[model samples]
Target: MNKPLAERLRPAKLEDYLSQQHLVGPNGSLQQALKVGIIPSLILWGPPGIGKTTLASIISKESNRPFYTLSAINSGVKDVREVIDKAKQSGGLFTQKNPILFIDEIHRFSKSQQDSLLGAVEKGWVTLIGATTENPSFEVIPALLSRCQVYILKPFSKEDLIKLLRRAISEDDIINKKSVTLKETEALLRLSGGDARKLLNIFELVVTTESTTSVEITNEMVLSKVQQNTVLYDKTGDQHYDIISAFIKSIRGSDPNGAVYWLARMIEGGEDVKFIARRLIISASEDIGNANPTALVIANNCFQAVTTIGYPESRIILSQCVTYLASSAKSNASYKAIGKAQQLVKQTGDLPVPLNLRNAPTQLMKEIGYGETYKYAHDYKGNFVEEEFLPDEIKGTTFYSPGESARETTIRKELKNKWGLKYNY
Candidate 1:
C-alpha cells in the first residue's frame, strides 16, 4: 500500500541514477551538455524501466527548471496545450533553460497531439523530452522528431542489475528495515526481464511477501512470489509485442478466431489504435499481398478510418480489418520480390541503366544512343515485346517469382505467355 519499492528507490540525482553510462558518464554527450549549459529537446527511446523518467527528472532538478510530465497514453492535445501554457508562463522566470515538458510513452501520441508540441518546442516555450519503447523513427511524426535529440537506453546490463539489487537492499528505507539478504539473484534477474524497475519490484515482492524481520531471496523464493502476483497484460513490457505478434501470425495463418482474440487482448490492454492499424497495414502487404490485393486497400482505409475515429470505434474498425485479412488468401510473393531486388541492388551498386532502357529526354541523351534501339512496347504487337529491360550484366535475372496462390498463378501465366521462358514464370 505504501509507495512501491521502485518508486521509493528512484534516484533523485544523476550520480545516483544507475547505468546508461554512455549518456551520463564523464565523457558522455549529455553530461557535457549539462556542463556546457545547453539542454536540447530529447527523445529517450528504449525498453521499460532503464531510468528514462528518472534521468529526465534528474536533468530538470539539476538545471533548476520547472518540469512537466505527460503520458501520451492518456494525455491529448488539450492536456499538452495546458501544460505548455503553464510552462510558457514560468519559462521567462528561468534564464538557464526553458521549463521541461517530459512525455512518457510518447510514441502513443497521434500526429495532431504531437503537432501541438511543435510551436512550444520551436519558440522555446518549453524543452520537450519524449520517451518511447518503440522505435521513434516509425512511431513519431518526422516534423516533431526532427526537432529533438534521440538517445537510446538499452536494458540494464547484468552487472547493473546486480548493483541495483545490492543498492536497494542497502539504501532503501523501507527495504533496508526488512534487512533482506540477496543470497542468490539468477531467478530474480530472470523474472525481471532485464527491466531495472521489474528487478526491484520482484526483489521487494520476494522479500516482503511475509511479515518476517529477515528475508532470504533465492531462485525458488523469487519464482514462488512472482507466479502468484505477476501482472498478465503489462502494456509497456514484453506482453505488448507478444500479443501483437500472435495477432499478426493469426491473420497470416488465416485463423480469424485467433486473430480476433489477440486483437481483443491488445484492445483491452489499451493498446494504441494507430499502432494496431499500422501493423494491420504491414501484415496486409507482407502476408496478404497479391493473393488478395484488396486486403491492402482495406488495411489502408482501416488505418485512415482509425486515425479519424479513435478508441472504442477504432476497435470496431480494427476488428473488421483483422477478420477480413484473416479470411483472405495470403501471399508473400511481392514482399519477397522487393526484398530480393534490394539484396541484388546492394550486391551490385548503381548498375547503369541499359542505353535502350534509358530515357532520352534531351537531344544529348538521344545522341548518346539512349532510346536508339529501344522497342516501345505500345508500338509492338499485343502491347508487349521481348527486349532486355534489366542492365546487360543481369539481363536474365528473375527477381519476382509468383507464389502458388491463385492471383499470382494468373500473373505467372500472363508473364509466361509474353516472355516465354525468359521470366522462368
Candidate 2:
C-alpha cells in the first residue's frame, strides 16, 4: 500500500513534532504532565491539519497505554460502549495504566452519543483524547466537557510550515532519493493556508510528479501545477472561515446585497444553520448594538427558529434576519466602551466599590454608614440624583461615547440634560 506524504511523515514521538511549542515545549504544562507519566483526559481543539491526531497518538505511545480510535462521523452510541468495554477489558477499570480512546471530529457526535462517554471517562476506564476543529464549548456536552482539559492547538506558523517542508525534503526516503531545492515557497504557503497536512500534501504533489531527476521549486511552478481557484465551498477547510468572515463584514458594512450573497453561498454549500445563526447574533450585538437593539432580538429569534427548523426551510428565516441586520443603523459604541472599561479595570486592579454602592442589608452594616449618603433617585426631581457612582481613585473617568446614529443621538441628548457635563457627554 502506498501512503501519502502526511501519513508517512507522521511524528511518532514528541521530539519529532512540529509547531505548537506552547503546548509541547519544555516549560509547557502538557509537556510537564507527560514527564511525570500523568495523562489526563484532554480535548485538542483547533483547525484541521494541525497535528491534533498525531499529538494524541504520541501521548498514547509515551504513556504506554492501550489505544483505541473512533471517528464521530461514523461511530454511534453502541460503537462507543463496545470500545469502552474493550478498553476496560484490556486495561482494567480505574487502573494507573488506563487505555487511551481518541475520537476524531468529536463535534459531530450527537448529545446522546456524547452522553454515553460520561461513565467511562468519569470512572477512569479510558483516558479520553478528543479532537475538534469547532469550539468545544458549543459542541461538547457540559458534563463531558467539564471532565476534560481543553488544550487549543493553533494553526501552523510560517516558520513552522517552512520547517516542515525542509524536514520532508531532508528526511523522506522517496523525496531524498531525487535532487530537490526549495527556491520559493510563497505559492505553496498561500495554497496551504497555514495547514501543515495540506502543505505536505501540496509539497509531495509538486515534488513526486517532476519528470526530471533534479527539481527546483518556485512560486510560479507551484501555481502552474495546482489549480489556483476553487468554486466549491469546503465547510471544514479555509473556505469555511473565509466565507463566514465575508458574511459578517458585509453586515457590518451595511451592504445587504453582499450579506445575502454570502448567505446564499453558505446555504448552497450546506453550511450548518446553527453556525450561521450564531454569527448573526454576534454581528447584531457587536456591529449594530444600541443603534437598533431590535437587531439583537431578531438575531436571537433567528437562532431559536433555525435550530428548531432545520435546513431547506430555515434558510428563509436566516435571509430575513441577515437582510434586517445588514440594513439596520450600525454602532460599535457599546463594544468599544466595554473594551476600554476592561482595560481600565485591568490597569486599576479591582478598586473597591464606593460605600453607597455596597448593600446595607444588615443593621451592623448600616451602623458603619454604608447607605448614609446614598440618595434615592426617585425622591429627587426628574426621578434622578447626582452622586459618585465610581470608585474614588477612578471617579469622572468616561468610557461610553455614544455613536452618531439617530437612536444614540437621543441618548447623548438625555445624558447631557441629566449630568450637565459630569460624564463629558
| Clashes (candidate 2) | 0
TM-score per candidate, chains pooled = 0.87, 0.90
Local error of candidate 2 at residue 169 (angstroms): 1.0
In model 1, what is the error at residue 138, expressed in angstroms? 5.1
Give the alpha carbon lDDT tens digit for every residue of 100-180 in model 2. 999998987888999999999999999999999889999899999999999999888899999999999999998887899
lDDT tens readout by residue for model 1, 24-100? 99988789889987899999998877888999999999888999999987899999999998998888733567899
Can you give the lDDT of residue 311 in candidate 1? 83
- Each model's C-alpha lDDT? 0.87, 0.90
Best by TM-score: 2
User: Which residues of candidate 2, in runs, are more than 4 Å off?
Assistant: 228-235, 267-272
Clashing pairs in 1: none
